[model samples]
Target chain A: MNQEEIIAVQQYENALSRVDQSVDKITVLMSSAQSLAQQGTQIMNCFAQLKREQQAYEAQFKELKLKLQSDLIKFQNIVKGAEARLDRHLDYIDKWTNLLLTRDLGTMDSQELQYQRNIMDAIQMANDNFNKELDKLYSL
Target chain B: MGKNKQVQKSSLTDEDLYTMLSDNLVELNEIELFFNGFLQEANVIDESFGTVTNIFNGLSMGVLASMNKSDNEKINRAKAKIALGTFVVGQVAKGVGSFYSYVKTLDRANDILVLKKEKAATWLDSLHRNYDRVLRSEISSRKILTHLASLGYQIDELISNREVYDVKKNLMQMALEQYRKARFNVFSMEFFIAECKAWLKNKHDSNMQQPILQDVNNSIIQEVLFQGDDYEEVIAEFFLGSNEISGSILFVLNDEQLLSHYLSTRKDPLIISDGVENKHINKRVLAIFKDNPALEMSNEFYEIRKEIDEDGEKSRKIFWRLIVTGSLLSTLVSFFNLYLFCRLVMAIDDNTAILSVLAIAALLAFGGLYAKFEEIYKELKNKISKNRENYERYYRYEFALKGGFANRRKKVEEVVGKSFFDRVGKAISSLFDVGDSDDHSFYYEKLIEREYWNPFFVTVSIMLILAIILTKLNLFFVGSLVVLLFAYLKMRMRKKYFYILTFIVVLCVVFLFLYMKGVI
Candidate 1:
């Protein structure tokens, strides 16, 4: 080849080499882009997992709160019932004591003994009820 | 020699020229594909960043809701830790995304730099100048023509029209335009990376010693979840050096108005109101002054602030003492009443006289206690109202000062219109009528001023009258039971329902009265 034709051939080779280098760089960039897309997908999955965990935790917490509130109400009701029973027992005892103070007993009489037995039975029943309530509260 | 060079240039055949131009065009197309790939990566990073922010917002809301909803300290701490962990994880994800973006941007920038240099070697004037037109016109036309050719259309005439379209020139233009766009994208990416770095730096600096994360956790636990006595100070300290105050912070603090005021006016001088002596609002004001040095504070205002703080401390002590004393007395009274009620019930079946005496005593005691309680409540209410009035006055004064002389004048006019002398005159006139000096006339005027025709007052008066009539008819126990039922309904039911019940009871009472009088 002549000098001008040789020069033209050399320039073409140089342009081809640059294009080769550009393709290599482009290939690397495309891979990096693919990796980023993968990373994005992973992040989305993680976000969904986190949301699910939060929802589960909230629902569990709400259930626990409701259980505790119901237990508290149950305990309160038991205490109130126990208190009313004790008051009734106290009133019965007061009446029995008043009867004893007023009635003079020289000997054991069936009528006074019956009245006393009835008062004692009522007091025993109240005691039994209070114990049952106490057992219920402790179980809770 | 020039003629020999021209002949040598023509020595290359048309086929060789077309092959070289087509090869260059293919390379340009590949580079354009890479640019598009880089752009898609950026979009991915953008979407991930958005998701991270969304996660952060969700975590913050969770922390706030958990703190507010739960009173259990352990649960609150656990929730706070979880929230902090999730936030840290989100931040990590964001950091990774940023790193990837930074790397890709640098890579793209380097590619564009090479293309810029290549412009000198090629026929293009400059890559940055011609890239856009080349990409839009030449590359787009090539794709469209190829698409049409694939659909069975012959476009050889269009392709061979060299005068209308030069292939090499179009490739050069496309490459240059793509280079320009890539360089612009690099510029934008670099700016975005810089912003990300700055944000990270700010976060690091703010979270250095007393990290906002830990502070928020502590505040949520101490102030919101537990409501510790020093909550005001805890909240104040939390906001002292905070650069970013989120909505969750305000929500947990439970005093959005106060915190928002502190934030909005942190740069300005502090204003202390008279009633602020009871609350620890001045601590937050001082915190503001500490955070922003540019804020101006007058010595007089500072002294007033100090004096008010001292007064607040003293009043807080007294308030606590009052609460303790009041609560103890109330508990004692309640126990006494409960005991008396039990005794009365026990005595009911045994001794009628004792029962009657005990019931009367209990009734008198309850009435006396209620009257005393009402008096104390009214006194406390009056004191609170007076303090509120003073606070409102000071608030208006502060507002006026901020709003300039025109507002100050307007406020002054308003104050003058409601002056103390005018209030005293109105009170005196309410007590005594000027039109009539008779004592009965004064009583009539007083009744009118009291609005005796008010529905509530009318209801109460009619109920009382019905109770007295029932008692006169020898249904004293029934009268007492009816009164108790009505009182319970009044306390427990809504006003509308209570009014309806009251109307029914009144109608029944009226019928009973008519029947007793033989008029029904």
Candidate 2:
């Protein structure tokens, strides 16, 4: 292989590693959100107990509990969406790595080059979806 | 042959493909970093929710304790009285809190106005700089292009070196667009500052309605939301647009590689091709090149300004409502005190009914006057103290601005030699510092010096002297009338006569002290 091809291969490997690291980070975020959801559930349970004992403030407790429950559901959905997008991105990266490894850069046809560009575009789209989920989580 | 050329152009080489991949990698890395930063901020917000929950829990416990019932009638009546007292005190506390918040908001509004003025000056300087760097260069380039075209040079050949001509044209266009956006920002900020000033002035006017505050608040919220919408536009136009046409060009014009590339491509002579249509230099581009450019206002400033206005508006409304409620409650309490006085006089002597009634009337008058005086003194003291601090802050800001202008002028003289650029710098500096030269600092200093001689202090002293004299002379009703008249004058008098009123108050206090000591 030529020096340019070698450099291209090195860059591709670097990109794969970066994508892998991003996937790991997303997993950590999902777990943290899961714990937060559990905490929210516990707080809701405590509110329910308080409502039973303090009938005078039953309306306030019910309102708070409902809000917490809705927030927890929203948080779970965001985590699920983020996880799915991260998986899709990993799949795209895998396809990209396979394409690079199997084909010689100088010998690739127009169809193969188009397919490579398509894979990169898919990865970018997945990144955008993940970012949207993060924005949802932030709002929640 | 044309089809073959088109096919060749459509297909990318290995090197081009690798370059594209590298760019994508950089973009992915940026996205990842953004995600991490967002996650960290979200975590902090999540932690704050725990504190909120704890506060809610404590409040619920307190509510439960207050809900418990008692069996004994006397105990129940006492409990009811305690609850009523707590309610009244809570309302008064809320009023005081609101007043404090309103004062703080006014202070913040004044600070924001000073900041906006400073920012306006900075923007003016940046506008001058941009005019010299971007607009002048664009104008000269357009003139050169037009001159060359008129001399029969083919624009296609001239623009073939995209690195030299096209980049410069694009930069100018982008800069002009940014400047246009900046002009809109400045206008909006100035409008907000004007609203804030109006709100401050309205507070001093007792006749100002609540609706005016609401209107100002609504406008502030609309401005804030508008700014948020503008941010999305900026991200799309500025950042995304930069990415589309050589990302580093707009941010780093003086980069070594770009400069070298431009310098190397500058040697091409103007050439003409017959019947070739010009694509690079459109009419719109040329028009923008001729237009003036302004400075870009940062989004952070808009965010901070919005927060200040919104917070101020909320506090002002609270202060107005609660203070009125507290005043009504105080009047009710005064009536209750009169009822108590009548009961005591009846219990003292039932046989001498008319004498007892007269004595009760006199006692009631004295008690009502004392209560009214105390309320007035408390309110006036609070307001005067806050106003004093605000005036001091005003003086400090004026002093700082004056000092800043002097330093700026000295720096211009020291750093810049007597060249054309230096002269332009001096002229612009002087233009912005025109307000400073008008002796605003001197005016503020004089105001601060006279601030200590407040009208409220004078009113308090005069009330004290009247109370002591009338009590000794058995003229309670006359004293009450005099006190009422003084209160009316105190409300009506302008702040400018503070020194004169203070002198009168001091004189009265000295005279009263001597009389009490039997020296007068």
Candidate 3:
């Protein structure tokens, strides 16, 4: 080629190389963008999944809480029944004490007096056991 | 087997009989209610299944488009994976929805049973509270010896009341049954939800595992980058071509309305063949022209064009019918008049009478021809104006497409330009009628689809011809009137029909009254 043609050829080669470099750079940048977009989408989907799971968890928790409350009420009712029985026993003890105290222990036979005392003690023990059970139920 | 069949045939009192029947009925009703509710819930679940699958289908398609890379095999493999993933997701959702619905039904049944149990519990509590009082009140020396031989007298007081015990037992049994059913339903729901979550996670992980396009050096990536000048072109190319970067672009331009509108408006039948609903068209157009702010038309342009076409069509149809009917009637009248004139000249020898008859016939003929011509002129004027408006819309849309780049604009213009009106015009002109039919036929076609003319008008036209023939025969005046009545009724049942009917009735009543009064 002539000198002028040679200069043109050199310029064309330089331009071609620059264009090739630019293409490679663009490809890299575009690919990065694509990956970023994909990641962003995945992130969005993750958020959605998390939200749905959270909602389901909340529903389950509500059900569990209701169940716990129901069990508590049931335990309370059992405790109340035990307490009522204890109260009735206490009432019987008070009535018996009145009947025994009115008769005068001094005039009563020793054996009969001893028997009454033992009965009172047994009633007291039973009442204590009932109260203990009630307390356990309440704690539960 | 029924309870009655299982129960022994024992003699019972009226009260016991009533109680047993009611108890059995209530139990039967509960069972019936559960099955009915379950079946209804199943139907709702089935209905939602289609929707859930469709949602996943759309999602997978969207994901596929967004992850648009150049490799055909990779894209196809990704497509298959996405399809399978979506199917799994759909199945999971379907299962979950169905299980949840079943759970809800069981929960409802459980709720009713719980309420019954609570009622029974409250009653039992009341009984227990009064148990001591009842015992103290009822117990005599002899009663204590008979009942309270042990300290289980209080328990016997409740247990001895057979009715109360049976009712409470039934309530507890029902409640337990409901709880069991609900528990099973809940278990299934939990399983389905867990499976769904796992499938979702797996799908997500698999999606993440796909090799990211880190370099855009390939011809495919280059082609994608230079697909079109605008967002719409990018969207279209992703839908149409195998672009490796579709996923990225779709995610970036994540307007569901716009995407749907684009897909629907695409001319390729294989693409979204069903055009988006009318409501979405303007939004789609605006989205496509978002970058081109200088575009003259607003969204209102579509509404305005529709309104103009509708209003213009109504009047044009009226004008066309009037012109056609008037011309036909006028021509017939003129020919009849000319024939009469010729007959008078040939037969009648009285010069004055013939001249007068000729003069009258000429005047009548002239008047009819003038009216026909006037109507024709009016019809032409209306069609020309309507056609001009429709044609201008095409050009305005075309100009809007000429934005930053020629190729992109050309594509957009081609899309928006070849819209509903243009397509109808082209279809009609090519297939059916061309020359003088252009202006009227385009509007008429649109109008006809909205208005049922073929059945009503054709019937009326046929009846009118029959009526005219019957009248010509002079055989039945009442028959012709009946035919006319039938034709009138064939018109749409709108306010106008009522008004016309009322008008005719009033006219008939007036005529009848006047005749009765000897005033006419």
Interface RMSD, all candidates in order, equals: 51.3, 24.7, 19.6
Q: Report how closely model 2 matches the true complex, as a DockQ value.
A: 0.01
Instruction: Write the residue-wise lDDT of candidate 3 on B236-318 in tens digits.
Output: 55434231322224222232222222332334311221122333223332232233222223233444454555655565565
In the predicted model 2, the residue pairs found to clash are B154-B271, B154-B272
Top candidate when judged by TM-score against the true structure: 2
Winner on TM-score (2 vs 3): 2
| Cα-based lDDT for every prediction | 0.39, 0.36, 0.39
Estimate how well candidate 1 is docked, as a DockQ score.
0.01
- Regions more than 4 Å wrong, model 1: A1-140, B1-240, B243-352, B375-379, B407-520
How many clashes show up per model?
7, 2, 12
* Model 2: per-residue Cα lDDT over B1-520, one tens digit each: 3423343344332233223322221112232233233334333333333333443343334333443643444433444444454344434433333333233323333333343333233233333332232232223223322221222222343234433333333322322222222222233223333333433443211122212111222222123212234422332243222212222222112222222222212221000000011333243222221221110111222243334444444444444443444334333443344445445643433333334333434444444455555565566456555554554444333333321111111111122224457545544443232212333343224344323323344545554655554444333443463466456446667765645765665676576546545587
What is the DockQ for all candidates, taken in turn?
A: 0.01, 0.01, 0.02
Candidate 3, after superposition: displacement of residue A106 in Å? 97
Q: Which fraction of the native contacts appears in each prediction?
A: 0.01, 0.00, 0.00
Tens-digit lDDT track of model 1 for B447-466 = 11111122344345434643
Stretches of candidate 3 off by over 4 Å are A1-140, B1-274, B278-298, B348-402, B405-520
